[model samples]
Structure formats: C-alpha cells, structure tokens
Target: MERAKPSSIKRATALRYMGASGWQPDDATTALLDRAEEKILAAATPRAAVRRLPRAVFPPPELDCGTDLTRHLQGCDAVLLMAATLGSQVDSLLRRLELTDIAMAAAADALSSVLLEQICDELEAEWRAKFAAEHLYLTGRYAPGYGDCPLELNDELCLAVDTVRGCGLAITPQHLLAPRKSTTAILGIADHPVTGTLAGCTTCHLRETCSFRKQGTTCFAK
Candidate 1:
C-alpha cells in the first residue's frame, strides 16, 4: 500500500506498460498531456548574457582537457550563455500516484527536453541572422562541456545568465542542474566571417586527437 502511495517511487515505468496493457488514449487524454507540456515550458524561465574579457592578456587558463574556451572564443563580438533547470511543474508528474497521470508526466518530461533543445537551436539561428544584419560573424553556438570545452564552467555560465530569474532551474550542490537534463552554452561571434563545421573542427584544439583527425580527414580551416 505504501508503494502505491507514490512518494516512495524513485522512478516510474508508465511507458513500459503501454504496449502490454492494450490501453487506448482518447483525444481528451492526449490533449491534456499536450497542455501539460505547454504549461511546463511556459513556466520555465532562462537566464542568459554576454560578458567581455578583461583587456589584459591573462595566462592561458588550464583546459578541462586540452581545450581552452578563451583561446577558441577570442575576437568575437560576444559570448552567448544560457542556463535553465527543471521546474516544480516538471517534478509534480513524477510525484503523482495515479498511473495514467504518471505517464502523462513522463510524456511531459520527454516532450519538454526535446522542446528545450529546439528552443536553443531556434534562438541560435535567429541570433545568427541578427548578427548578419550588421555584417558580423559568429562561430555558431557551442556549449561549455563539449569536445575540449571544460565541463566545470557550467556553474560560471549559469551565474552569468542570472539563471534562477531567467528560468526556474538551478544547480544542485554537486553541480548537477536540477531536472537532470537542462543545459547551458556559449557562442562565439567573429568580426569577420567564420568557417563551416568542418573547418571549425580543424581549428579546434581537439582536432589533433579527434576521431576525424585520427582518420586523416581534416576540415578546411579559414
């Protein structure tokens, strides 16, 4: 009985039962879940910003690997950073006792994460167009924890973005962002034109030991 009460659940298996249960959802049920996902996204807030580096050339910061963001990110108009985490609304579904409701909640989570990534992509594209208007160039967007970028800078990026106000998401004491899958990123802008993904790869610090590089394939660097 206590297990059925819902609070004790570390995880739920709503999707797992759907195939075997032979249950059919009506329009209303589907609509309800869709609405819930919208609500979750609407409730989400994000913090983002661009910061200028100090004029004095500082010592090259140690890389999380051999990657240095400052070196790679230099000569850009600004660095775009965003931070967000799971909100209370997202937590509610996991805490529900009803099996159907729990599934809907899981649906909401899956949809929300996908939507969140979409938002980032959309915003990045829009920003690219905006910068183009002024004949500016950018290196596209890249997050802190990818390739040679240091994963540890996640905290600093969050703070720069005013994360809590912009979004309900926050990081846990251990540096894990609440909701588990939230993300942050940095975009580099160039005064002149930047090259393509293949070229970017070639110039990247990771290139020497990168899988692509290992295969003797190389990007055309500008």
Candidate 2:
C-alpha cells in the first residue's frame, strides 16, 4: 500500500512535457497547466515494487534487448525488475478529457507524463537508500525500450514482477505498457556503486532527434 506522494511538481517539468522548448508559459498554456495539475493530483495513485531476478535469466527467449543491457548488468550480483504506476484512474481521467476537451486532454497527458517520472524518481531514491544500507549500490535504471532493450521485453518484465496483481499494470501485445503512465525497468546491483558515467540518453534510440535533446535537456538527467 506504499505510494509516491509528489510534492509541488515543477511548472518547468510540466512545460517540458507539453513540448515547450523554452521556459515561458503563455497564459493559455498556463491556464491549461493549472487545470491539468488538479487532475494529476486527484488521479495519481503512485505505487511501485521491485523484485530480484537471477542473472541466469538475463536474455529472455526471443528478446533482443540490445548490448547496452549486457554491459549494464555486467558483474552484477542479481538483476532487479521494477514496475511502477500512477494507477488506472489517471488513465481514465486522461481518456475522459480526450472526449470533453482536446487541449485539456493534451495538457492532462503531459501532466501525467511528468507525474509518472516524479513517481519513478521517488521509487529510485527509496531503492538507493535501501541498497546503501546493505553496502550495495544500483546502476542507473535501464528500462525496456532503452538502447538495445527491446520494448517487447515489457512482457517479460510484467511477468517477472507480477505487475498486474501487484499494481494493476500490464503490457499489450503491441508492447505498450498499460495504466498508460506506468513504467517497467531494470537495475543492476553490486557491492560497489557503478564507477563511471552510466549510459543514458547517449544510448537512447531517439537521441538524434529528440525534442528535449535539441533543447539540451534529457529526461534521463539526474
């Protein structure tokens, strides 16, 4: 029943979600963001769970999660499969907005996107602290759809974490994650923290043309 209680989501983060390259928010955008924040606060039900998976299960059958993952998980004691969600109500709210108001719908979608990342941020912080207590450290979170990690691996992640039962999240046959704002990712655990810079946006498939990248911003920046 643990949950992520995000406090004061930054306007800049939401603006970025709306594809805003600059800091200024026009009146209309500001108003939409104001309204969207209310929806996010009401709808968010952040929840997360992490489970240990033996390294032997690294490459699930038919999964082509790229070589980046192979390097990330190298010299690990075990792999951790993580799943987190802002819950189904958030999706329901976004869907309802699509029919009622297109602008609001888009704004709501953006807000939810930022909120989900905030939730993941909280989850990672908690995990980091927990592992530190045991003299262990975690590699940066590497999710399916990152680098060589195929989106299809979502199925394996969901199954490994029992995501549906644990948090009402799932992956579709098309590889999209459900509870639309939810996420599944992996982390490598070791006695020592990762020594060098971990590959993040530099290894992303969309690095070349990502809008945020063009603005010198990366979603993966810590």
Candidate 3:
C-alpha cells in the first residue's frame, strides 16, 4: 500500500528536460525508461513545508547576509522559508541503480532532478494562490547557493524553518542537503506585483561549468 503520493514530474521545454536529465534516449534506451520512471515514482515520498517570517526578524539585521537578504527581500513584508524532499527511499533506489545498472541510474537521476523542482514549483504555486487572494504577490524564490548566497546559509535556513522536524530534511556539516534530492529557498511576499525572476545562468557563480547551461538548458525556466 502507498503511504504517500509520488512527486510529479515537470517536463522541460524544447528538449531541455532531456538535457537536464543528461540523456537523449534512442529506441534502445527508450524501452527501459518506463520501468525506471516507475521505480522512481514508487520510491519517492514527496514532502514540503513553509514558514512565514518577517524578513528583518528572521535574518536579524546584524547577520552578514542581512544586507544581501534585505536586497533580495526588497519590496516585501515577509519571507516564506521553504524546504522540500523526495525522501530517503529514492536515495536507496539511486544507490542500487548505480551499482547494478548505470544506465537506469542516469535516467533515474535526471528524473529525480526534475521531480524535486516540480515539487518546489507546486508548493510555490499553492503559496501564490493563497497570497493572491489577499491581493499580495510572491517574488521569485531565491535559494542558498545561488549567486552571492552561500550554501552555508542552508544551516540557518534549516534551523529557522525546522526543516528536519517539519519536513524530514537535513544538511550536513559541509552544507550538502540530505535525501540527496531536496531543496530550500526563500520567497518574498509583497503588496505590489512581484515577478519571481530567478538570477538565471548569467549571474550564477557556476555558469561556466554548469552542465545544463552548457547544453542550453536552465533549471530556472518555468
């Protein structure tokens, strides 16, 4: 019996999903994808949670990121701190695929990448609708590890949102997110219309070596 619904897949535009997943399937490879997808879906346990906090109180003006955070949260009254994951089962499945079947592992990995983003998207969409009812709008989400935001901030975010307690998400000392298929981000809420525009490849610190961007793909695209 299923305990939880599987995370939904977000298809990419113009074959970008294929690039994000790192595979262009041929007829031979196509036969195995259906099964691979099933494996991923069956193993995934999608979970997410959001916490609303005044931008100033949450970040503390004395904190180093406060300046940047203020800039990021400009024109907003609060920040929606979010965390989400596809659970540990997907991690085990990926490990098994790595040892027993490299091809399937690659495909599963790509799908997981898309799935996690899709989960975040769904959560954001719900928040958008909720806030829109009040005539407020959400700004584009900004995550740690993007642009000047340090991955180290993952710790603060986890603590602030109690991600481990609320959504079963954790971060290692090195700042690697646990479940290996999870994300945390900040969304701004304001009275005026706020278009959530991501920094995109141009401003990304890793733009040069980004495999997706190199292949003409971007994770920021809707």
Q: Which is superior by TM-score, 2 or 3? A: 2
Tens-digit lDDT track of model 2 for 107-130: 888878877777787787888898
Give all TM-scores, in the order shown: 0.55, 0.87, 0.86
Q: Candidate 1: where is the Cα deviation over 4 Å?
A: 1-65, 68-78, 84-86, 94-102, 165-168, 179-181, 195-222
Model 2 Cα shift for residue 5 (angstroms): 2.5
- Candidate number with greatest TM-score: 2
Residues 1-222, candidate 1: write the lDDT tens digits: 000111111111222222212245578756755565565555544333334332122112442423355555666645555453444545554455135666566566655565455555556676788878978776755665455555566666666666666665566676667655467766666678773232256346476666545544442211
The better-scoring model by TM-score among 1 and 2 is: 2
**Runs off by more than 4 Å, candidate 3:** 1-8, 11-24, 66-71
Best by lDDT: 2
Candidates sorted by TM-score, best first: 2, 3, 1
lDDT of 1: 0.51
Q: What is the C-alpha lDDT profile of model 3 across 49-103, one tens digit per residue?
A: 7899986676555546524445667788888998989899999999999999998
Q: For model 2, which pairs clash?
A: 65-148, 66-148, 66-149
